[model samples]
Target: MARVLMYTTAICPYCVNAKKLLAQKGVSVEEIRVDQNPQLRTEMMQKSGQRTVPQIWIGELHVGGFTDLWALDKQGKLDGLLQNN
Candidate 1:
């Protein structure tokens, strides 16, 4: 499986949903909590170009937030992304 990383906040529902979805896929996520640190939040925004709680990355691919991830899964493309780089 690909390495999954997510930039998230403590109380964001989207982050929770994203984690749950990834859990269902049996994929481990490296979560970075940006709620406590401004630098990490800046890094996430710079990397993803989005000021969102759940900024997701599958390997080197930026998969956006939970909605984007869900869309990918619905399209049946998420598994391939998880398995491939």
Candidate 2:
């Protein structure tokens, strides 16, 4: 199983949905609250190159935001990314 890391805020619906989807997949996520810690938001921007909540990472792979994640799942590529290669 791959480790999941999500940079989120307090009230992001996409974050909530992403978490729920991951939970359905039986994957535990490490939630980094950028709203509480401002530095983390900077780190998220640096890491993902995106200024958005729910910046998700599957191990070392940057999976972009919720829409990208959903696209991967729709394409049947998310499971392959979650598995250990």
Candidate 3:
């Protein structure tokens, strides 16, 4: 399986949902709290090209936010991504 990384804030519902979805897949996420560090938020923006909480990376693949993650799952593509296939 691939490593999961997420840029999230303390009170973002989307972030919570994203975590829940990943958890359902039996995946562990390394969360970076951008709310605690302005610089980290900036880095997240730079990498994701979006100023949004719950910016996710499954291995080297950028998965955007909760909506994108959910879409991928609905399309039956998220598991392969998580498995690094």
TM-score of each: 0.98, 0.96, 0.97
Off by over 4 Å in 3: none
- Quote model 2's TM-score: 0.96
Q: Candidate 2, which segments miss by more than 4 Å at Cα?
A: none
In angstroms, the error of model 3 at 50 is 0.8
List, residue by residue over 1-85, the lDDT tens digit for candidate 3: 8899999999999999999999999999999999999999999999999998999999988989999999999999999999873
lDDT of 1 at 32: 99
Worst 10 residues of 1 by lDDT: 44-53
Q: After superposition, which runs of candidate 1 have C-alpha atoms over 4 Å from their true positions?
A: none
Instruction: Give the per-residue lDDT of model 2 (tens digit) for 30-77.
Output: 999999988999999998899898999999999988998889899999
Worst 10 residues of 3 by lDDT: 76-85
Per-model lDDT: 0.96, 0.91, 0.95
- On the 0 to 100 scale, the lDDT of residue 26 in model 1 is 98
Candidate 3 total steric clashes: 0
Task: Specify the poorest-scoring 10-residue window by lDDT in model 2.
Answer: 76-85
The top-ranked prediction according to lDDT is 1
Estimate, for each residue in 1-85, the C-alpha lDDT of model 1 and write its tens digit.
Answer: 8999999999999999999999999999999999999999999999999998899999999999999999999999999999997
